[model samples]
Target: MSVATLSLFRFASLRSRLWVIGQMALARRSAAWAGSARFVKLCGSGSGVGFTPQPNWSVWAIFAVWPDEARAREHIDRHPVFARWRSHAIEDWTIFLSPVSARGSWGGVNPLIDPSAERASRTAGPIAALTRATVRPQFALAFWRRVPDISKVIGSDPKVLFKIGIGEVPLLHQVTFSVWPDAESMAAFARQMGPHARAMQAVRDEGWFSEELYARFRVLGTAGAWGDKDPLADALAGAAAAGRRDAA
Candidate 1:
């Protein structure tokens, strides 16, 4: 099937009940079309990442990949969810979507933890080479917190390739959007010291990620201009623009 990627970086103050209703309306419409044969599988998922004192003022990055833009647009236009946004359309929130040509993995390493940067650097080399060969449109983000550091433990063991994308909704929860080079890599990674698994075990053994939450997604599509915008948008846009510049 032909595939097109769509990513939306949106902001909302969870304090407003209308936002919740709009989401409900949209879901209802999608459910209505469930029986249609023209329907194609949509890999839709996203998460939020930010801090807002009020539950109402939260930002979320939502993304999904569709078979094509036409289907994506059709879903949005005829969906009951659009009605909920009539009064608040583009007011409290904004959406940006772009079509993805390909997808891949990139990762960041720390100088402090990897004081030698040997293991960190060495680990990335093979993984990067494999990802380049198998995946396209690669990107990575750096985190100053202990989370990523602790997370990398999983990537290094058993020659695991670390592929992590993180997102969130306001102050609620953080979602992890990740893609491995292949099913084998993912299976192997899962069997070893992957951070999420380690962290979960740590928490169960003790109490950890005490206040943090994470979700994972199999990316669908990505679109829109990045920078001076959402971080994820910027990354995807940067990757796309880079692809164009490379071809030129």
Candidate 2:
């Protein structure tokens, strides 16, 4: 089974922050990650709901796809670049994911393997949805104009456990990741006749993105913390409680 790991690094000092910035380019050519995985990307984040135009230099992410959990864990244990990043980061977190469903292409191919494709009816667990896009230059302004409303909607959504805007490029390439209690809640948010729906419609009508990908994952597990706590703790606890009640 293929596994995906999204590792977030938070640098506090100015020097450490500058080093991570340099790694954005150097890490690409490093032997550690070079040809070492099914896919790899170094990403920067945005401010506010992570949708704004301004960049958040202090936080960066390493997203990679591996053959299995063993290989993924091995790399995380011994990869020098990863170790260095963690050494500098005041805080960091990594989440392991197994694709439940994925469609479209990213950088010309969808790197995730949907292990549950044949039997993926488990919409009861924690669900993470990732959407990535390469915006066309002509439609950049128009696309961004619609983001604030979408961001606001998700930001205030009580059911949204966690959400962030991360991307490869400032304006040209954008990615959004969000976690929902279940698939139904996620679908409700996406399909509701509101800003998200309207913007999605505009994308189809305007062809705003040259390339796009959408993938959903079943949360395997996590290491470390975000904001000093696992963002999924409450959600997972609720799911566990619900399961126990059903068994009782």
lDDT of 1 by residue, 1-248 (tens): 32222233233445444464455335434554463212211111222112111232222222333344566555544444333433343332123222122233212211012122122121110121111111111111111222334334433444432223233221223333333333456556657636655654543354322233222222333333333433344334544666588789
Candidates in order have lDDT scores of 0.32, 0.80
* Model 2 per-residue lDDT tens digits across residues 63-120: 8988888888878767887888899999888878778878888889889855544437
Candidate 2 lDDT: 0.80
Error of model 2, residue 59, in angstroms: 1.1
Measured on C-alpha atoms, candidate 1 has an lDDT of 0.32
Worst 10 residues of 2 by lDDT: 113-122
What total of clashing residue pairs does each candidate reach? Answer: 18, 0
Native RMSD of candidate 1 (Å): 14.1
Off by over 4 Å in 2: 114-121, 146-148, 238-248
Error of 2 at 140 (Å): 1.8
